[model samples]
Target: MLVVEQLRKSFPTAQGPLPVLQGVDLCLARGSSLALMGESGSGKSTLLHLLAGLDCADSGSILIDGEPLDGRSESALARWRREGIGLVFQHYNLISSLNVAANLAFQARLAGRHDPQWLDYLTQQLGLMPLLQRYPEQLSGGQQQRVAIGRALAARPALLLADEPTGSLDEASSDEVLALMLQLVGEAGSSVLLVTHSPRLAARLQRRCVLHAGRVQAGPV
Candidate 1:
């Protein structure tokens, strides 16, 4: 579903142009799950951003289902993201004023692809039915993260990108959330690229890749 070739990215620093990803290459099959493991500065999140088209790479190419993504304009990339990608961040990036239901439906509605039955199913599966009317501030961190996961899946995206999704939750909450996420992603038939620091979390995924020194290490899960 996704293929990246010799992907390279760098940012201007006081020292010079510091490179984050150095010729990274990866390919993700449709309906598969991959765990991206790395240290703090290993560019895992940067790689996810590049794959999601949230940021541009300085060089190399990213292809989604065989379409070249490197040269798309910002608007084009935004449209593509709305139609094909769903993102879950470490922090629950929920809108403060919007209630859970509205927040979950927001992106799907914006993409003109809202599915009421699917949204209902998501709410039920994520155990968010009772909390639908509550705002982010009123919910526990685990509940908010559940809402965030539901929101991401509401769009039925082809590719799901999760960056440290369980990082902020307690152990039990984290396990619950991760299990639900894995199940939901499997049911949705979407390929997932999840970035995480925990080995236990990484071990649960179907495949794993470790990022170090801006490059991906090849090995089995």
Candidate 2:
């Protein structure tokens, strides 16, 4: 569902341009799950952002489904993201003013494809039914992360991009959340590209790729 070729990205630094990714190539099949493993400065998150079209790459090409991701304007990318991609971040990016239910339905409603049944199912699956009326501040870190995952899946996106999805949760909570996420993604028939640091977590995925020195290397466990 996603293909990236020779992807390269660099950022302006006080000293010079800081290169983050170089000649990174990856392919994710439809309805498959892949884990990206890397250390702190290895550009895993940057790669996710590039795949999601949240940031532009300095060079190379990205294709989602069959559409090219390069050369699109910011607005065009935003439109594509709304229609095709769902993102889950390390930090739960929930709106403080909105309750869990509203936050979950926000994107789906905006896309003019709100499915109440699906939303309800997601809430129950994420163990978020009781917290629907509560705001982000009222929930614990794990609860908030569940809500974020719910919100991302609520859109019924074709591609799910998750960056350190369990970074803020305890061990039990992380395992629960990750299991739910994998199950839901399969049920929804969506492809996943998850970035994580845990070998145990990475081992659960169908395929694994390690990012180092701005390149991707894939192999068996």
Candidate 3:
């Protein structure tokens, strides 16, 4: 459902415009998952940000289900971010003042697509019912990550963008979190584009692509 064509981006540097993503092409089918692997500075995060609409590519195009992603106004992109996509990061960006239940429901409420049934299902699957009243500070890393994943999937987003989602946890915690994440993503039927450096983690996804020298290539990074 996602297509990127010769996507190119560059950033300002002391020398000049330092190119990052150079003619990167990618495609993701609906409800499928893709792992983007790269060493440091390979522009994996940059490509993810561009697809997330948090940043724009300097040239080329990104299409989702035939709709062009380039040239949109800030407001339009903001709306798309709120309603059309779900995002998770290494850090759990939960609202400190909000408890687990509120945080889980936050995005869904914003999208005007809140579903009590879906939220309940997530709560049950994530084993979050007992922790519903707790805040982020009171939870463990795995617990926090679970809440983050639940919040992202609460809206049943067509796509989910995750960047180093399990970076903060220990090995066991990371494995557990990733497993739960993939299971919930399947239940939610959301397409995933995950940016991570771990090959073990990348292997769990349906497809893996490496970013090297600003271009996407098949196989390991």
The TM-score-based order of candidates, best leading, equals 1, 3, 2
Q: State the weakest 10-residue window (summed lDDT) of model 2.
A: 105-114
> Candidate 2, residues 1-221: lDDT per residue as tens digits?
89999999999999999999989999999999999998899999889888878889999999877789999898888887887888899898999999999999987876676899999999999989888899999999989988888888887888999999999888888888899999998887889999999888888899999999999998574
| Candidate 3 lDDT score at position 197 | 88
**Which 10 residues in a row give candidate 3 its minimum summed lDDT?**
212-221
lDDT of 1 by residue, 108-170 (tens): 997888999999999999999999999999999899999988888888889999999999998
* Overall local distance difference test of candidate 2: 0.89
Worst ten in a row by lDDT for model 1: 212-221
- Reference-based TM-score of each model: 0.98, 0.97, 0.97
- Looking at model 1, residue 215 earns an lDDT score of 92
- Give the candidate order by descending lDDT: 3, 1, 2
TM-score of 1: 0.98
TM-score of 3: 0.97
RMSD of 2: 1.1
Model 1 stretches astray by more than 4 angstroms: none
Off by over 4 Å in 2: none
